[model samples]
Target chain A: MVVRGCENRSVNALVVEKQKSRENLFLIGVPCEGILDWHKIVSEVGEAVTAVKEDGQNLMVETRDGYQLLERADFLHDSCKRCIHPNPMSADILIGEPLPEGDPNLARTTVENFETQTIEDRYAWFQKEAERCIRCYACRQACPMCYCEECFVDHIEPRWTESGATPAGMQGWHIVRAFHQTGRCTSCGACERACPMDIKMTYLTEKLNHDMRDKYNFEAGLDAQSQPPFAAVTLDDKNRFTVRGE
Target chain B: MNHILEKHTLQDLLQSWRQDYDVYLPQKMENFSHFMPLTETSVLVDGDPHNTRIPPKALFLPMNEALVKFTRFGGYEDAKHEIQSRIVFGIRPCDAQAVQLLDTSFIQEDNIDPLWSERREKTITIGLGCHEPCQTGFCTTVGYGPFDRADLDAMLTDLGETYLVETFSEAGEGCFLGLPVASEEIYNQALDIQRSAHDQMPVAFETENLKGKLEQNFKSDYWDTVSQSCLGCGVCTFLCPTCFCFDIVDETQRRERVRNWDSCMFRTYSLEASGHNPRPSRVERTRQRLSHKYVYWLDQVNQIGCTGCGRCVRYCPVGLDIRAMLRQAQTLPFEVSHAA
Candidate 1:
């Protein structure tokens, strides 16, 4: 299995989880060069790219009229830029020379950048992003960690979220889905890539990942032996469930 | 009605038209031109007419449309009561013809779709003739051209500094108020531009024999091999201009009967309540898509379902090219029909 490191928490968790029962799992890791933001390319080209060829670090696109060149660095998904681990942390067979570590401050800068905005601005941004969601569950389907046979969104008995393409429904679906990933989200950028509508949904997961790292001192899928911080709790774990005054 | 509008004059016209109509122009956003509502800051990039990633089909048939709204207390109510009269400016010729094909699929039938027809009636399509057809589009082969003008009320041909406008319907005639008539030189230049655009579009394949080829090869293994790489995503059918299939889903709590766009590629599209699915696998769904577009569409609507916008070709996560499949389909040995 070619483990797309750091961003592939869902797959990593699954593989690690499987290791408890299954023994013969071999992992071949490849250093990720960051996934291309195809939607960015589509938007830049001003038309659907009929033909695409990658020449080194450049993407050559053929539209109806002519060719357009896009630098790969300019069109990488935001998660890829924030990804700290490109090479697999624990792989039996590692492919190619391990690349240098990504900027340590990338995740903090991204989180802080979004954090600097006012609550109203943040809400407005969320609403704007959520409104574009068609609720096709492309993000959910794209997620490797979202392996729930009966996703809460699909539960008609309790009905966690109403099945509508409205803004409120979209927001509910996204927030709930993103929350489900919590510590497990490896920031793989697959959900963003899989989305046909090109909704930038990784921001939700990335924020959660930042919080997990900050509060719990946990980064998911780094070690197979250790249990997920969220799953394994001790007396020392922070009990913030009570009201502040109480 | 037949006047040359200077390229700069278009901004003024659009500004004025924005007052009366929710004018949609192909505005360049991050990567592509989308038919978005005209804002004060909107700038038109007329160099490549094929710039818009998504077709203008959303003007009539929206991606997710609610058909009937029902509440526990208030039975059922019309979902889309307030239909806005809008103008879609700078839509490509292929997409324009695709809209006409949608009219055939939805409105021209005996039992016309109320929502589709209502929207179609209110919408005014001002087609901008493609100077150079998109490489993926084979509209010329599929009974249309860059400047075919199948059902466009108005057509604009780019003639360097000015646009040669021609009105085909009353709506087109009503769009202009004080524009001067085009000179003979301008008209000839428009004609030459049209001729060159038509010639520029390289036909990928001949569609004349496609229907026959598909009809004979229903059991062909080509579908299985082609669909092997398919992710079974709805990108193709959802983006297709003429695809009008919808799933009428009832929101129990809200009691609203919503008609969301459904794709045949999905397993649930053909699934029955009894747990039996007609299209159980990707192979069958892929075959159905090919047959529906290339074979059944001709029989039902007398037009190919695909306008060759190539959105499916470009957008498919798995890179499934219909043109390549069509080319492959052409080579398959014709199977003997039982009726024959």
Candidate 2:
């Protein structure tokens, strides 16, 4: 298996969950740059684009009209813009030159930007982004952590959320989807890039990731053996939701 | 009914109809263009001649809608949602054509869906021809065009500071009744613009024997190779202008029978209640999606199902181009399948 930073983390997490045997796996790891946003390129170059050649940090785009030189960094997807890790942490074989580590503050700013807004403003922003959802589940399908045989949304007898594109239904899908990735997310930004509506949702998961980091001093999938806060049971645990006479 | 509508006067004319109809036009969303209702402060999106991120089909079929409302004691009633008359102005020709194609499925004499039929009846489409056709679209190859007038009530040709409006119906003519009739010289200039715009689009694929090739090669390894990178996401079908499959669900909490958009690309779409999926994997799902458009639609309607609007080509997560797929399908050796 070929593993980038996110894919490597996903594999480690899966191994911890007993979904795969690490002994049987041979992972070829590579340093990552980032995934480019196709919409950004199409928006700038228009659909007349015949071909795009990725040469380092520059994109030589051939359109029906003429040629265009586009800066690759300018067109990176939002989640990739704030990536903290670009190199696979654990692999059997490491390939290519390791890229420079991304700053943690960039990911922090994304969470902070959403968290700083008023509760109503936060809800409004969420509502605006969520309303564009077609209930396609493209995000779930894109995520490596989301490998459930039958998804909760697909269940009929005990419907967890409204089975429509109404406001409530859409909101439930977004919130619950992020919640499922609480300690499992590798911050790949594949979900955001996969969206047809181009709805920004990594912020929600990033917020959960921020909370996991802050409360439990935990980061998911750093190694093959480290258990995530949500997955492991600890003797010393803190809880604000459930009443406990400690 | 050819007339000249000055650029400055277009907004006021749109505003005047607000008293009677909900006028929809493509306007700027966060980054891309979207179909938004005209308000007093609405500014029309311009500069790029491309289709909106969302197709106009949303105006008619909608992503989801309540078909029936349930009462306290198991009694059910028609949803009876009031649909207002709407003017879908500046709809692209490809999108407009898609609606007309969908009418065959939704509005057949033997079987009629009330929700879709009612919405279709209430909306009027006015097409805005693409002066510079989008790079991804291949309407010409699919027997449609950048300036197709088959389903539009009125078609507009961009003439710099003005629009050359050609109305095909009484309702379309009524919208621009007061506009001055265009002269022969101006009409000829508009024709030149339309022709040049049409000339810009290259035929994406050879439709000749393409359907036969796909139908014959149902079990080819080509499906596996092509569908390898596909994330099995619904991005392609959901964004598609012509893909109109939906699933009905009984929402007990909402007390309504709602219809939500479904896609063949979904594993669950073909999944039977007995824990068996007819189209088991992404390969089969991808084959169904492409074949339905290329083979099935042609067999049913004698016309290609895809409008070649390019939403699937543009929004595909894996960057799977249907144009490229169809062109590659042209190379596969044709053979008769016993099942066929």
Candidate 3:
């Protein structure tokens, strides 16, 4: 594998994971500004938007009518909005300035905003978003972590969820798909980018990543030597699975 | 017959049509405008005609449709299908052309798709001619234009405060009853506007020898470069005005056999039950998608599948431009390994 352009933490994680056995992997990282939020761009300027040019802070969108300007921060995707590692953690050669750090509490505030919402409101939001899902599995195909040959949603005979367009079926698919990436997801936003329906599924994975970090004090793909917290057997691990006082 | 109707009378005209046909016009949605059923609060986007974010094809071939129903003990039964008498207004010329392309495939001899044919027969298309083309649109290059009337029942051209209506069929002529007839001068002006609209559209490519160019580069390494950035997602296919691939599955729980929109981008799309796959990687899948538009459809239907609506270009997440791909393929040097 040869990575030649813009630095991404997901690419770093992938390299670290594969470099364990594959000695031929080479990574040449460059500084990344951020990935554009296409949904936000078209929404702000309407579907007739022509050329979208970006510098660092703003986007200039051209249309038949005229050109319109938009703030980059306001339109950035949730993952990109809170991205802390614009430079790869480990690289053989780096090309740009190290740069100032971003807001450390951005992820915390995002999770808190969702947490503050009432349970009913959250459920309603989840259901409404999930209802838009067409079971295309584009999200699954885009995510680097979703490599299972037989995803539970595709299993027959003892099917986890009946395959159809029903609301319940969509909910089952989203919930199960997100749960599978709980500790492994790198907050790469590829799944959300790939979704044609623009379903806001990153919230589920983000929330799960937060819980994993807070409970286990572990982060995924940050280091080459560290095993995934769930996969590792450690004496210091907490016993949350046991019955109370048993 | 040709007539001119004032902009203010549109509400009354739509109300009259509502009594007979389910009238749908371009209505602004969250991020884009699409043809939605005209309601009390419906408003056209400043009375401007442009391509909708979702193609008007949804009305004929829905995202999810039931083809057949089944019971465990009993055999299968045809799904209860209702054909609605409908009129879709403000359909852009490219989308209207896309419907004609679909007709060649679905309403063909010996293999007619009953549901699609029924809906198509009952639907009347009112095409809105674009005076100024959208940025991504390249309809003129693909043998259609902003003012093309090949597939429209009635064609409307914006003439300042009025819409110049030209009827091509009896069904279309019925719409101009009791309306002011367009003067010869006004008709002449409409013609000039259409000519300028055609001139204004940026020509993307000439398809005179597109099939030959594609055939020569079937096994080129160029596909590897194009497919690498692709996420293998269905956004391009789903938003496209002409893509018509579908998958039929037995939804046993619903007691129905449902047809859903499927993409060639998916790995499972070409997967075989015996663990053998022909289009195993994105390279082959990407080539198939492009070839289907530029090569195979011509062999099957006598017309290219792409209408140049440019929905795929604007909506692609990774910014994999199909226009760029086709242009690059024509010029890119490659060796022919084998026949494809």
lDDT of 2 by residue, B1-340 (tens): 8999999998899999898999999999877788989999999887657789888888888888888999988799988788999899999999999999999999999999787898888888899999988868999999998889977889999999999999999889988888999999999999998999899889999988888898889999999988989988888898888899999999888888988889998888999989988999999999999999999998999889999899898778778999998989999997546325
- In candidate 3, position A99 carries an lDDT of 52
Model 3: residues with Cα > 4 Å off, grouped in runs = A1-8, A15-23, A38-72, A134-136, A150-158, A162-166, A233-237, A241-246, B47-50, B332-340
**Could you say which candidate leads in TM-score?**
2
Number of the predicted model whose DockQ against the real structure is largest = 2
Over the stretch B215-270, how does candidate 3's per-residue lDDT look in tens digits?
77778888998889987777788788888888887777778788877788777789
Give the Cα error of residue B47 in candidate 1, in Å.
4.0
lDDT for B79 (candidate 2)? 87
**Residue-by-residue lDDT tens digits, candidate 1, B166-193:** 8889988788667899988889889998
Off by over 4 Å in 1: A6-10, A17-26, A38-72, A150-159, A225-227, A231-246, B18-20, B28-31, B39-48, B71-74, B206-208, B212-220, B252-255, B336-340
TM-score of each: 0.87, 0.95, 0.89
Candidate 1: clashing pairs of residues: A7-A188, A43-B30, A43-B31, A43-B32, A44-B31, A46-B31, A46-B32, A46-B51
Candidate 1 residue B233 Cα shift, in angstroms, is 3.0
Better of 1 and 3 by TM-score: 3
Query: Which has the higher lDDT value, candidate number 2 or candidate number 3?
Result: 2
Instruction: For model 2, state the Cα shift of residue B337 in Å.
Output: 13
Q: Looking at model 1 chain B, which ten-residue stretch has the lowest summed lDDT?
A: B331-340
Clashes of each: 8, 2, 0
Native A-B interface contacts kept, per candidate: 0.18, 0.78, 0.35
